[model samples]
Target chain A: MRFIFKTAYEQDIRLFKHGGQQFWYGLLGVALLAAPWVLDDYFLGQLTFILIYGIVGLGLMLLSGYTGLISLGHAAFLAVGAYTQAILAAKGWPFPFSLTAAALLAAATGIVVGLPALRVKGIYLAIATMAFGFIVEEVLARWEHVTGGNTGIIVGQLQMFGWTADSEESFYYVALVVAALVTLGVLNLLRSPTGRAFVAIRDSEISARSMGIHLARYKTTSFALSAAITGIAGALYAHKLRIITPEQFTILQSIEYLMMIVVGGIGSVHGAFFGAAFLIVLPQIVAMVKDYLPPAIGQATGLQPTIFGLVLVAVILFEPYGIYGRWLKIRTFFQLFPLYRRGLFRRQKAFMKSERLR
Target chain B: MQVLQVVISGISQGLIYGLIALGFVLIYKATETVNFAQGELMMLGAFLGLTAVTFGMPFWAALPLAFAGMWVIGILLERVVLRPILGQPAFTVVMVTIGVGFVARGVVTMIPGWGTDTHALAAPFKGELVRAGGLVVGMEHIVVIAATIALSTALYLFFRFTRVGVAMQAASQNQLAAYYMGIPVRRLNSLIWGISAGVAALAGVLLAPITFVHVNMGFIGLKAFPAAVIGGFGSLPGALVGGVIIGVVESLSGVYLPEGFKDIAAYILVLVVLVVKPTGIFGETASKKV
Candidate 1:
């Protein structure tokens, strides 16, 4: 498994632990930059949407995947950001200021939602977040002045310091840059003490508290930070579509965000991006394959969700570590071909039944 | 008189909610896992009943058939998807249920002609009304209340007296201990799930006359959940009381308060209950093992 030798202490903690990882990431960056030129307009739009989803997934991964908190209300935060940005942008607030306001407002709401975490965890916290999401959705739908009621509000074009990202290619580049910055920010945070503290909390609250980590502060901080990033994604999402609606941020959207992390591999930055791409692209894949299926199943718009739900169940049952974990397993098997034991990948019964370490 | 009318209607509405909340309590008590699919199960039951009626079956016969079908679905789900992942993390089990719900809704929505359109479930009562104290009460509401009482009493009797019910109680209290004592813990779990699903089906059948059979009706599970939370998640009787409280508040607020309060009344009640007593009105205090 150890491809590159690391002699210095810093080498072990570096962003890319090996030369191979750096090379792959460098190649990925180039591919992303050249994607607009290579792909058609339709695919470029999909990529932009995937990048935004990736940003939201990263935020959720921090709260749910790394911190062991379950929230069915992330979409509420997205709505807050979208509405905030839309309202501010319509009022002629500067682009950066409106975006900042969106993040701040979302973070404020996140903290309010996180307050329940002080008293509850697990299923109860999930319910609280769901309630929050519903409340936010209702408020958005009813508050006509801000959200334009059921009709929804139109978001203006993205303009920053005399630069307009009116074209699809330009907007795609904007999304890509924001996504890259957010990803790097998350990577940096994960290496910091706060991220480790989050992991510790996820593993065991009792042990984490014993280590003098303040539960209330850190949990809310994770919520705030996660919401802040999601808010940024929401702002970009609004600009990308140039229109926003409360209906767009439903519980289903929130579930999709959770699915991204779960399918990609929870508790990893790579998982967030991988899950985002997989989910965003899944509909296209299904559409392509639909023609080959029986006519009875082919025309159902609902089949995609059914397949999505089944995939979630299958991943949870068969490969709890998700797509990234499966990738690791395959790579390890190839790396140690002909020498690997069958039991090497067999799940321990104790781990299955015992308390989860997230 | 108006207040009394509101309370009566609220009680009937709450009873329907209670029936669904009862399913939540039964499953939670038996398995210690929240069944997010309960509402969808209710929707499936209603649709099944509608299908049976559409096929020329009498309303009375269709209702029982729907209940039985839902019971089978519940048992199958527990035996197949749930049993395989038994003893997994609570979060994983919860997510699986959520997935189950998503699949259930999707499958129902894909049922070709019947799936997309809303239809009326033609019950025997239909739109018969009774006059009482200058208020007209629908007979359907009375039937819902009556059925809820009958089912609750039957459930109470079963748990208190029947051998299987006693065994189930023992298993719920401590599965390992019950197993050691020669009880069929796993079988009891399936039985519990079946009963829960049956109850949900009954709720669906009872509610169909009032709301009409629609795919989106399962969203009522959203309201029912708050009822469960308000009553204390694990308490069966508490769930009923919680439902009543939520229903009465919503009914009154819809008339008295400003617009939109009715929709959020239950959720607000849940939030308040959680803040004041996180364990809920009837839930036992759970202590962590440090």
Candidate 2:
């Protein structure tokens, strides 16, 4: 194991802890920048989706994973973003302005939802968010003049100033830039006092309050920020799909977002990207493996969900830390080699913690 | 008369929601884990009843059989899937249940005869109607309301008088203390799951008459969340009351309000209730000591 002696306080909050991390991240960044040329258009499209989902995953990770607040209605924010972008685009607004408006609108809605969230915690908060999701869906469906109701509105191509991103490769670059900025922003935020407050609140709300952290302000800020990030992803998603519909943002879609963050690893920024890739790739993998299995199992309409459900269950049961956690374990096993212990990462035995009292 | 008719129908519909919510409360009370798959279990129960009926069994016999079968499945689910994950965060448990729901729905759809098609369960009182004082009521609705009343009464008595039921209450109140008192908390948890499943099965059998059985029927479980919340998370009778309130509001809105209000009336009501009274009507307040 390589250990770095930290002689300065600046080293504690450094974006890159060691030379190895900086080099690997730089290499990874280069690979992403070159991906459009190296990979086929089909793969590039999938990568773009991973970028979009990664953005949303980061948003959710900040809220649920770091802040200890769970939302089952993130898709509603995505809808807000998509619909706003679509509407503004139809009105011939600039791409940057539309995207900003989408984020702001979603943030506003998030605040509305977060207000009620202040009164509840845990499962109650989950249900309230879910109800909010259902209500938003209903509104989107009923507001025919603006949203086009069930028929859905067509989204225009990405237009920036005078130039238009008509090609898939150009769109990919746009998404890459936004994703990088967001990732860097999140990294910086985490090392700051605000992010520390979020982590503290997540670990123990009472203790966080006792330490003078403003609970209501931080919670609402987290919700607004999370929603804004997700909204940006929604704008990209709308352009990619070439259509915006109310049906696209449902409870199931929200669940899928939750699944991405959970499967990726909840607390880590890298986990969001890992989860986005996993979510995109899992379906493709299932489609490929379908023909190899027997007709009864393979051709069944329910096969995809069955596989997805089973995988989710298995992941929760075996590796609660998710794909990122598994990667960490593997890396540790190889690093420690002969001295690796089985109980190195064992979870502490937890008794049933009652929510009733809280 | 029309108002009464709507209210009556709403009560019956709400009763089904209550029945499902009852299952949620029972499981929540015992294990403190919310079962998101409660609706899927109800769907399975309906399918089981349908299968039994197709095989020439009477509806009466099929009902009990499905309940019993679901009871066993519930126990197995608790023992095999949930028991291993004991003491994990509530979020993990909730997600597991959601996964279980997906698997249940997927497996049901993959079944040879079930597939994606909707199937009507053959109730003995399929199309019969009763007219009283210039008001007409479907026999199916009456049967649902009657069955719910009977079940709720039996449950109330069970929790009140029976030793096992009292033991369950004690376990739910304090798991460690109950275990220390030799109440077999773990086993009781399994049985609570079984009872919850059985209750859900009964709800399914009753509900199948109003809405046909289908793979997607489990989606109705989402609506039950509002019901459970309105009644307070831990209160049994609160669930029933909440369900009825949601039902009446939905039914009334379908007729009185403009186009989409009916679809979201329950949610709106729940949101209002959450804003007004977060713990629900019967919810008890407690402070945690750190």
Candidate 3:
């Protein structure tokens, strides 16, 4: 019902399919820009965190969703970025320089970790990454001079070119601009040949290899790019939080990113934003519900992760495509309401076991 | 003498790791999906064992009671949670098991006093130390090592000689072929889950004397994962050997290396093994059909 009638290659590859999408996106953009002014300081801070997570989620989506490489140690990369920035910033490096340094350091680490991707994949890759995460955490905790050990580093206000995002309201704008730029950058990359190559690898590495896609080059590049993006997000997060610690970026944090991609929609760029917002907001929603429940149940922090687990299971079971997928279904149903068949959306099979790139 | 003492203690700890890794290998061999909840299952087993003992059940009786209870929980978990998504993607299955772990940990934490606090399991062998020609090891360590040997031998014989065990093996190798041959593959899967959970319970009971009973004991399950990987995810003997290797390495490193090296030694070993031999020590070469 919402078919796009494209007449040219340019039109077919345009970021927006039609004027309607552009309008909606523009309206959303305005709302984000206006958010700090409308919302209180507490909510504004939450928005900053969500944007940071969105950046992290985007990096993961590019690797896991697009490249079909699963990693459970993303938090380790984040730690690398954060520590790099924190250490450099403490030594009086400017904001942009430290941020770039962070991304470079994190990317280098990602490449080393991605070396295992050449030999193993799927669960083995996941285990390797997780092991890497633990190693980074151990190093962070023990290397007291550089990482400040368990005590952590306090990042001062971000300053660049005589401008400072000292206030929550001001910092919101900086995060907003960076997130928008990254999201747009990712969208453009997806339309590029490299993005198509990633999808090809994900769908079937054997087929992709036959089609002349260099597995090592593209795979490592994906890892490096993803790590760089996540590192930038980490650098932003460190500045926003003003204090950073190894404990903050644990394996659990990595899993939370995976949950975001799964719950948002696995293979879509929009899914990254949706997942980040959902996960960031879900805990707040849970905290609000505490008032109605009994004291013990209400106050229990463990309840949050319990609900996250249940949501993840429910999402995978019912809507494997996630909230975005469900939305598409509902929108399609409405568009073709009278002509919709009883089993219009029915498939021959529900779940396909993804083939690993061994 | 110090080295000998460490080796003795390491073997004991390693056996416990092997016990938990056995549970991991069991489920992976049968289902082909790593159950991230294996640790929480071990923790649950420990809690149930503690509860039974607190209710005046003797240590011996409490052990089996806990095993049986865990067996039921395992069966119910497979039936209710896992069965619905049996043929789904392996990633989805893995995630669901992680969810199961989260739920298990959350539910355990909500159980008031039992969930929040750490308590000694008060085993029959508690606090008894054994000395043999200048080597001193706790009686708990001796029991753990002995129990591991007995369990491994029993499992080996069961698989080699028992009809149902063979049936399970047949099912694991190729579920559809076994199914066509009139094997009840689904029921076997449930039994496998039950057995895995029971093994996890055994591990918890054995480990409780050394580490004490606490919700956080489930974290050891994460450590066991490295053991399973080092041993080969699917091989039982590999899991045992891997566990001892990890345990000994950890104990020795804790004494000889820098402060934090011991904590990460298992993971480092896993990374090295993955790089050097992706299939692990006893893992069969998995061929992918194009």
Candidate 4:
């Protein structure tokens, strides 16, 4: 298998040329599409949330992985969308139209936030976005007329031409389809000229600027684009929960979205889904073990938060690219079996050597 | 007279923020990474102090003990969570800290007795009003303001005069050179983190009286970030100046601005500060490396 895959020719870089990659991706896709049919209500609900986060993660992949601008404020965009859709839906607007408006609202806000990126880079940009998130939450809480003030406004069922999307099953399918479509859109985006420019900025902003790429324009556009996707997810979430409180849009949620990006693999398009799934599954598993704990322990201790912290710490300490990146490598290792390990190590060493040269 | 009182009140509260900013500066000085969880650590400190006080510990004893507890927590946090991710891109480390912050808040809220309920940390000084020639003030407020100033002065003196201080400064200025100079740079880094945590606890313990001690108190850290920016990210004194500026603006806004705007007063102040002087009042512009 290794012999057949290895090539001396530069043109032989076949990602899916081997049957294994195709088979694996195909099987994975099938499983995802089939998930709603087999899963119970609770699991379906959680899966829908994961898909929402995965959609947000796709945006982060573009901004952080592609454009190299770290956004701590993506969740703020999510909040903007969630709040916007809730308000619109409460006013008798169609669900589809509200969701679209949610994306547009987020994109508009994203442009405003992205303008700051023209001046600030990296951590500075992160802080600006962080501030933006805080400001958004404050607005949501205070704007009583539109946002139900501090109490927050609840959203009605997602109505698509008289069909209700209130059940976990319907939401599951909706989430799956939306996630797939958004993922496709994002992957395609990465293949475009703007995507390459984002990659160039990520590698070296000065070189990118030198290459005549409008750094500010692309950098900020990444924020707008990422925010729009996150907003769409937020809109879906608001509809799913039937509640859109300012509390739901805390800065903490922003951190969770970031965790998705990091845990799934910072730059990979698929990393978001992988990261969101891990987070969602871990908590569910934790909850499932709840009954087994001693009453005293269960009553007193916050095992859930403690577990989250430990998982985050563990992930950062070892697999920085997250489980997804590691899984990719592990799959390749198995595909090549014993013979492939040598090739992997060789590639890694060369990669490391080149980094040192840089 | 009322306006003066408000300004004084703002300055005093600002002192506490400045102190928090001091911790931020101290950590940033040693390690370039920002400690997003410092607020949570501070909240933990006040809670610990509350526990200490309720356990019949004397104020002095409880304060110092709580400070020590915070220092240990800080060190443990760095050793367990942060140390491993030292060389990862700044974004990864920041996100880790942010996660750590959430975990801290969640854990604090989860404590059986705490239950997200707000409680007062019984202060030694009764918040009795003192009429200083028609200018009313709380005695406790005076104490907090004084203590922050005194702490800031001590830090300034220590940094200027002491051997360890100078070495730490050297580390902050250039890590490679400090390492080459036989300084235990990594140990120094841990110590800085520890010290920063202690300072944050002190700020929290002091601030807990005015704002009730609860799980959400950790969020005051968000407000403190604006203080850091206002003072200039790298400047210690600027933190003091920035905090006071934000405090006064917040107080005045709450009094005079339309209801909703006061909630965003600190952020607006930060924006103004950033616009006026991006590096902050006392910050020097940094040159990009070639």
Best by TM-score: 2
Per-candidate iRMSD: 4.5, 1.9, 3.5, 6.2
Model 1 lDDT, residue B230, Cα: 86
- Each candidate's number of clashing pairs is 0, 0, 0, 1
- Which run of 10 residues does model 1 chain B get worst, by summed lDDT? B168-177
Residue B100 in candidate 2 has what lDDT? Answer: 90
| lDDT assessment of candidate 2 | 0.89
lDDT, candidate 1, A1-358, per-residue tens: 4567668988856898877888999999999999988999999999999999999999999999999999998999998888888888778887788888999999999999899888888878888888888888889888887689888888988887778788889999988988999999998898899998999999989899999999999999999999999999999988877888888998889988998899899888989988998898898899999899886677766678888988888888788878998887888888888677767877655222111111
TM-score of 1: 0.94
Clashing pairs in 3: none
Better of 2 and 3 by lDDT: 2
How much lDDT does each candidate structure score? 0.85, 0.89, 0.85, 0.77
Candidate 1 regions off by >4 Å? Answer: A1-6, A350-358, B157-183
**DockQ-better candidate, 1 vs 4:** 1
Per-residue alpha-carbon lDDT of candidate 4 for residues B1-290, written as tens digits (9 for 90 to 100): 88988888888777777877888777765566678888888889889888888788876788888889999988888888876665455676777887787688767766666657887888877577778767887877777788788887887777778888888777666566677788776787788888888987887788777777888787788878888888877667778888899889888887888887766788877766555566677766453433
Give the DockQ (2 decimals) of all models: 0.41, 0.60, 0.48, 0.32
Native interface contact recovery, model 2: 0.49
- RMSD per model, one decimal: 2.6, 1.4, 2.2, 3.9
Off by over 4 Å in 2: B287-290
What CAPRI-style quality would you assign to candidate 1?
acceptable
Candidate 4 structure quality by residue, lDDT tens digits, A1-358: 4445455663253335567668988898899788878888887788888898889888878888778888777778888899888888877788779889999999999998887677666555677778888888888888788889888887888877778876788878877888888987887677677888899999887688888998778877888888899888998888878877888777777777788778888788878888888778987788788778776445535577667776776676677677776887787788767666544533221000001011
Indicate the TM-score of model 3.
Answer: 0.95
Error at A17, model 3, angstroms: 1.6
